[model samples]
Target: MSIKSATPYFLLNGRTEQAIALYQRALGAKTESLQRFGDVDGSCPTAMRNRVMHAMLRVGNAVLMMSDGPEDVKLPEGGNVSVALDFETPAALRQSVEALAATGKVLERVFEAPWGALFGVVQDEFGIQWMVTSPLK
Candidate 1:
């Protein structure tokens, strides 16, 4: 069997909506589809029924998937994973960094890297880390 595509899936605890909103504002992401737990068969708990079961967000050319996972599950503290975004221009990269910094923590201000590209890192309010970079000219 051959693998087709790999997508980043986020289990946002109970903050799926908030994460989606942040992505939309920072990355110009568009919601392709969203499904509430209540939309599924009656197996979901009452409290979770109104929560997002699944969502598809289109950010640039990538599709980011997300959901409000099971109520009993808790995300680990300081996870090692991060979402990397590469931009075609340095101006675009800086704009995205500024947008995310409005509501997120900028770990690194945009600067030219030793590899000859502009790079920065930000951790959003939802605790998702993003590594933003611009292609070398």
Candidate 2:
């Protein structure tokens, strides 16, 4: 078997549901699978019975995984990863940027760059960072 380089995972402290919903709206992500801790067959700790054990979403060409962090898990002050989106057309790209920005802090609004693309960065309400880009014709 071959191994892929790496996959992105969000360790939501207590808002897996909200974060999932936000991503659905912002990126058109579809939930492919979800496994709740409670759904696990007997054996797992009772404290984790209601937590989100695992979830997978398909957004564009990427797959994102998430889990509700343990109640006692210490959350880091900042997230280290950013999800980047590359759009095919300016209209779609602009629309996505606008929509995503509505519920996030736009670190960089979409704008033309010397590299011949429109690009921006946003930190969504849940603190997940995103980078959006659309190449110029």
Candidate 3:
């Protein structure tokens, strides 16, 4: 069988829900499904009961998977991976950027790049990084 599609899986420590909410507001994304840790096991730690075990978000035509990682593991820095969002218009791009930046930090504000496009980097409040870009015309 051939691979149908690949989605990025974002593993946050304890803020997957908030991140999902932000994504919904920022990109008008839809939540296809979300399961809390407790849903899978009643014996799960109380702290993890409310945490997302798995969640699927539909952004534009892409699906993103997110979860609150296991409680006892230490996560390393998020390196070499980022979600890239492409917008069709400047207004749409700006609106999304503003929404995403409310509780997020801008790594690089959108600007005209030498490559003839507007590019920027931002890390959401939940710690997932994003590369926002749009064509300049």
Candidate 4:
């Protein structure tokens, strides 16, 4: 298969581990690999070394990556963009939303929209926005 330039890469703060876990619970994420900052065998500072330097979780067809922020760097406020999920079934859609709501804020409930698809929006506990939907045939 050929690659495309359309995929997104999110830059999260110091909660890489927690974010990964949340996605796992809500999206059936399977962590492909996680390299801690301490795992960086280079000459990086001790404080910076043990932090998450790089980690990847494969959530279905998407790959989400994360890492720690600089020592004192704070996460930014709400911005553009949200994760989009296409569910395979209505049951999956409902279950996923309920699970996500456990640790996140539900902006909207999953329901049939005027656009002819069931959709909803949420913000995970880690402050990441998500939009789940399933198209009707």
Candidate 5:
């Protein structure tokens, strides 16, 4: 068996662009690729022509894949899966948390744990949950 790379993929109904912009601003993520439904030939509804058909974002070395499609059934609170971002500095960690928390909720504000690490959880505006962490210097 051969596995070259693994990435987290998100399916957000009518919100992929918003989520992509949030990550790009908060995590220093770069847009690797984007293909809108409009790019497809008659595959999507004209109402959803501007919707995201596919997108790839690079945060550090991690690649995030996503698309805006049909709305999903509401979970208890979105879902159980969480995307975590580990950082090497306090500034980086803080910046990310603040960015993701914009128009969102901070489940756990950044704080020092007994293990001498900073940790927190935030659900982005799109209801996607995330864990942010950093080691104390």
Candidate 6:
């Protein structure tokens, strides 16, 4: 069997909406579809009914899937996973870095890397790490 596509799925606790807004602003992400827990046939808990059950976003050529995970689960502050974004132009990369940094912590400022590329790292408010980079000109 051949794999069709691989997408990054984020379990945002109860902040999926906030993350969605941030991605829209920082990465020009568009929500292709979203389903709320309330959409289910009255099986969801009252508190979680308003939360997002699933959302599909299109960022550039990639698709990002996310959800407000079950209430019992708690995500740690930082994890081993990081989302790496590669841009075609330095300007685009810089723009995304600034936007993400506005509401997030900049672990590394954008700079020329030894590998001949511009790179930086930021941890968003939701604790999701991002590595932003662009190829050398």
Which has the greatest TM-score? 6
Q: For model 2, what is the C-alpha lDDT against the true structure?
A: 0.81
| Candidate number achieving the greatest lDDT relative to the actual structure | 6
- Per-residue lDDT of candidate 5, residues 44-105 (tens digit): 66787787889999999788998886544432434678988889998899988888888799
Is 4 or 6 the stronger prediction by TM-score?
6
Kindly give the stretch of ten consecutive residues in candidate 6 with the minimal lDDT sum. Answer: 71-80
Give the Cα error of residue 96 in candidate 6, in Å: 0.7
Q: Candidate 2, residues 27-124: lDDT per residue as tens digits?
A: 78899998888797466788888788899999887899999877788776238888788888778777767777787778887789889998888887
User: Which of candidates 5 and 6 reaches a greater TM-score?
Assistant: 6
Task: Residues 72-100, candidate 1: write the lDDT tens digits.
Answer: 88876227888899998987887888888
* Alpha-carbon lDDT, every model: 0.86, 0.81, 0.85, 0.77, 0.83, 0.89
**Residue pairs that clash (backbone atoms under 3 angstroms), model 3:** none
Give residue 128's lDDT in candidate 1 (0 to 100). Answer: 78
Error of 4 at 10 (Å): 3.1
Model 1 spans > 4 angstroms off: none
lDDT of 3 by residue, 85-130 (tens): 9888777777888888888888889999899888888887876788
TM-score of each: 0.90, 0.86, 0.86, 0.85, 0.86, 0.92
**lDDT for residue 40 in candidate 6, whole number 0-100:** 75
- Measured with C-alpha atoms, the lDDT of residue 120 in candidate 4 is 92
Q: Which of the two candidates, 1 or 2, achieves a greater lDDT against the reference?
A: 1
Q: Where in model 4 is the C-alpha error above 4 Å? A: 1-5
* lDDT digits (tens) for residues 36-83 of candidate 6: 988974887798888899999999999999998888888764467888
Off by over 4 Å in 3: 1-3
> Which run of 10 residues does model 4 get worst, by summed lDDT?
5-14
**CA RMSD for every model?**
1.7, 2.3, 2.1, 2.5, 2.4, 1.4
